[model samples]
Target: MSSIGGFLAAGLIGAYKYRTRGTMSTSVFLMQLRVAAQGTVVGCLTIGLAYSMAKEYLFDKAPKENAKSLTN
Candidate 1:
């Protein structure tokens, strides 16, 4: 969910930049999309990593019972 949001935000920002730059060439469009995707992936991964670390160290201390949790 957050990854999708990051992609959307990146794409919107790229679109805004592209429009402001006034470059409508195919190459420029593709470049902008590539940059957005790369940025989104990196950002999503970083956030996921940080969240996982925080969950591991700063919050939960009990062993997970996946089966029990799934029935909830």
Candidate 2:
């Protein structure tokens, strides 16, 4: 999914460059690489954030009570 999105974004950028300058070349491929790198960084950051949030919300918090009460 991320690869697809990155390629789509890179293609858009390349198309824009072609539209303005009328050419696509190695530089455009390099631009695609840069875009893919950006996508990878964003994906890693998102995963890290979600993991941290889930840990904090679930494992790190105090336990909660159920509906039944325990009495002697």
Candidate 3:
């Protein structure tokens, strides 16, 4: 998901920049690639952290709840 988001963002930004510059070159393409790579790393870390926190919050107490219900 993060990679997909980054790719889409990079494509949009690159296209806008290229259009404004009125030229397309290898350097521009490379720059966009770099941007996409960096974005992907950042996005993945952010999304992963959020997922971990959410999972912990949603399920961290399930075991204790189950144990209590069994005793009752």
Q: Which number leads on TM-score?
A: 1
For model 3, residues 1-72, the per-residue Cα lDDT tens digits are 966876798689866766676565868767876887788788878999999998899767665553454454
Better of 1 and 2 by lDDT: 1
The candidate that wins on lDDT is 1
For residues 5-63, could you state the per-residue lDDT of candidate 2 as single tens digits?
A: 86798678766755666455768757775787688779978998999999989777776
Across residues 1-72, which tens digit of lDDT does each residue of candidate 1 receive? 966776688778877877777647868787868976888678878998999999998899887776464454
The C-alpha stretches of model 1 lying farther than 4 A from their native spots are 1-23, 62-72
lDDT against the true structure, per candidate, is: 0.78, 0.75, 0.76
Q: By summed lDDT, which 10 consecutive residues of candidate 2 come out lowest?
A: 17-26
Model 2: lDDT equals 0.75
The CA lDDT at 53 in model 1 is 99
Which is superior by TM-score, 1 or 3? 1
Clashing pairs in 3: none
Give candidate 3 regions above 4 Å deviation. 1-23, 62-72
